[model samples]
Target: MIKLTLLLLFFIIFIKKNICWSDEPHMIVSAIAYYNLNDKEKRILNKIFLNYKEDRDFNDPITGALWADHIKSNEHSTVNPSDIRRYEILDIFNEWHFVQIPYNPTKMFLPHYYLNAHKGKYNAMGVLKYIYKILIQVQKKPRHGTYFSYNFYLRFFIHIFADIHQPLHTISFYNEHFPNGDKGGSDITLNYHGQIGKLHHLCDNIFYSRKKHWPHINPSILQKEAHVLMNMYPPEHFGSKLTIPSNKIDFIDSIANESHQLAIEHIYSHIPVRLVNKDMQIKVDQHFVINLKGILNKQMVLAGYRLSLYLKDIIANIPEDL
Candidate 1:
């Protein structure tokens, strides 16, 4: 009986270790939209996203202690200052709003269980973290007032909005083998175009390929859909409950396994179909309306809605009218 029980445990661990993961393409589209806006708008958006990125704990210099190191190292370089500033802004946004979850392609594995375990809990912390960042920023530059910079505010607001919408960003995965690590869905691997790739980028960029192509959609319709999907699953099922931090291997393993599964399901379900073409080329029709373009528009709308929500919160805290 003892031997049998040990075998069963080993089997469960084996299965858990080999799960696959992916991110929804629509989310990437939203991110792109937030990132690609003109300079006037990009600066404001940068501030909001930058705030969130700073709040998240990452190895990057901007958010980490090494940020000054990065600056000192690059001070002598002849690179464009504007570009560097832009990159700095984006780096800051990515750390807090985007969790770089581990993922691997070529294994055909999914980490649904890992993501599900952290659905509700880690996400709330992320939200609060972002909110707290905004408050700090406001307090630091109170003299700037809410009217400080519309462009900056808009850009910041939109990016963070999308961040919160990404289910993986909100949850965490814990496991005895890898305790307190939130790789999102990056930890899983999948087969893509005959090569191994990370599941996190696959889901973040490729899942909604159509959106990148189209880039326009009715904002109202998109918001309705995102809201419905986000609210579809209960927070607890997604690991919403707060808990005391610990390093128990088995306990953490269970959470990671569950969170991975949830992230896969939630992202896959909303992946826009237009973005799913095996070939990079899209079929053009006589109607002058590209099939993929239509899909892209829908994604843009969804992104816009989510962006609006995130911005609304940040904007509210500011003392000026945006």
Candidate 2:
């Protein structure tokens, strides 16, 4: 009995740890959006994601299956220095790559991390600053006659964009009181519609679940809500006491609206939402029930539009295609 109990406890701990480390669902959706492209667009996207897959070694059974097709066959073998040169190509997209890392969440709330080398309490930021410099070097290399791989960069761009948009990914709890150990807001607990849950899991997966679907709201409504919230709360409200009071219907409404907009724009629109019945049955007609396909269709249009904007700025300086 004692041995069995120990084994059960270990299993429980293992599950919790694994769940904690799972990739954010929104990132998954973004990756899928890139994967489902076709022709010229698909080729360009493939070149980018191929590099990301190799760098991250995304071969785990669950996540790997989603990205396995894009992993390079020669990635493990010897290759010329120029064969893996997209890191240099990233220079064309440097402005997007640069993100502010949040330290001292009490005073400032930013998300994302970079390598910094400075000493003392601020040393991490210094390391991030130095890393950014190195990244710039990689970006400046010539693309002369060099064929670029599309596999990793595609997924990397998609993943990084989604990661930055996540509020928790942008902020840190670095104060002595909170110790900055919330694992990107996953540590904080809250009653999400009466269910006991942690903020991290809530934002990452639970929020993506179809079982407890949140209502859909338009962007204008969300914009208004965000404006109101920005006016009502101080930045410090995002600190340790991150709670939505019972009386704050407006606040809750605003959050739900904003979350829904983010969902519509960044997530729901990018992939098909499969609906499953209580008996574990799949609903075919309702497969893309979230109305995400239309949303993704729009996002692809937006991505192409945005990509053109960057291409115009960067490609104009490059040799013209014959």
Candidate 3:
């Protein structure tokens, strides 16, 4: 019920802060995920809406995907019982979307013990564990009178599935300038094509320049993109390479591992980070842009496809009691 209220007090804080991708990409991923749902999975999703149809948004996966971000808006912070404290308390939800896996192996890294001590903190990995537990509970016991609780978890899971795939979100590189962490490149500024911005925004703001190029997201387009990416790197690659994890921890951990590796090998790889006009900025060479675009496309496609599969498997495989 508290989560439902928190989510209901929506959109006041989110727009002011940075977002992972513009709504378009998130929508695209949701649409693609919807496309991948089997008929039985689709029916199970509709069942979650039995008591929630009036809420409406959760019934629609694309809009449902953005609900978590919407609730982060600031006005909710003021309206809640704790007033300002509500914002402070709710701020943790933002970090729940991104893991801060350390990138540098050579530097004086924060000990694993230090990090493990912080478990249940707002980092993406920890929050994911919490969220998954809540989801399993909601699935098993459900709320007495409302589907709102179930709806909230479903919506949040939809968004984070997309969020973790954005490599920068899962990575926190530590080095000389950023002795603590780069806060996913927000601390590092970059100059791309004469425009200067934080390195994180360079990745975050990779939006569609022309509508014609990106177009409105729909299942068809998402399906096409998903297939293209899957054909290049089949879903079986991950499933076949390792034992399919049985629990939520191992499941979410696999995705985080992929995200962090991408952060080191692709997002942070060989990019020149130096000062320009007294502010640090990363230099984007032509080849880097080419690769960056490719990686982003692949990540988006992969996120959508996997999110679909995850939801599908969960519903079809759940105990009949659920």
**What are the TM-scores, per candidate, against the unseen true structure?**
0.37, 0.36, 0.72
lDDT tens digits, residue span 59-152, model 2: 2211322232223232322223354322222223222322323334244332334222112222222222332233333443455322223232
Arrange candidates, best TM-score first.
Answer: 3, 1, 2
C-alpha displacement of 251 in model 3, angstroms?
2.8
lDDT string, candidate 1, 253-315, tens digits? 333334444455544333322232222222222121223223333433444433433333444
lDDT of 3: 0.61
Worst 10 residues of 1 by lDDT: 13-22
lDDT-based ranking: 3, 1, 2
Q: Please report the candidate that would top TM-score against the real structure.
A: 3
Which regions in candidate 3 have their CA more than 4 angstroms from the true location? 1-17, 47-59, 74-92, 109-121, 137-145, 205-243, 272-278, 317-322
Q: What does candidate 3's lDDT look like per residue over 56-127, in tens digits?
A: 333566657766665564553213525222332345477677777776654555767435532445766676
**Candidate achieving the largest lDDT:** 3
Q: Give stretches of model 2 more than 4 Å off.
A: 1-24, 27-39, 47-100, 103-153, 174-176, 206-322
Displacement of residue 56 (Cα, Å) in model 1 is 25
Give the better candidate number (1 or 3) by lDDT.
3
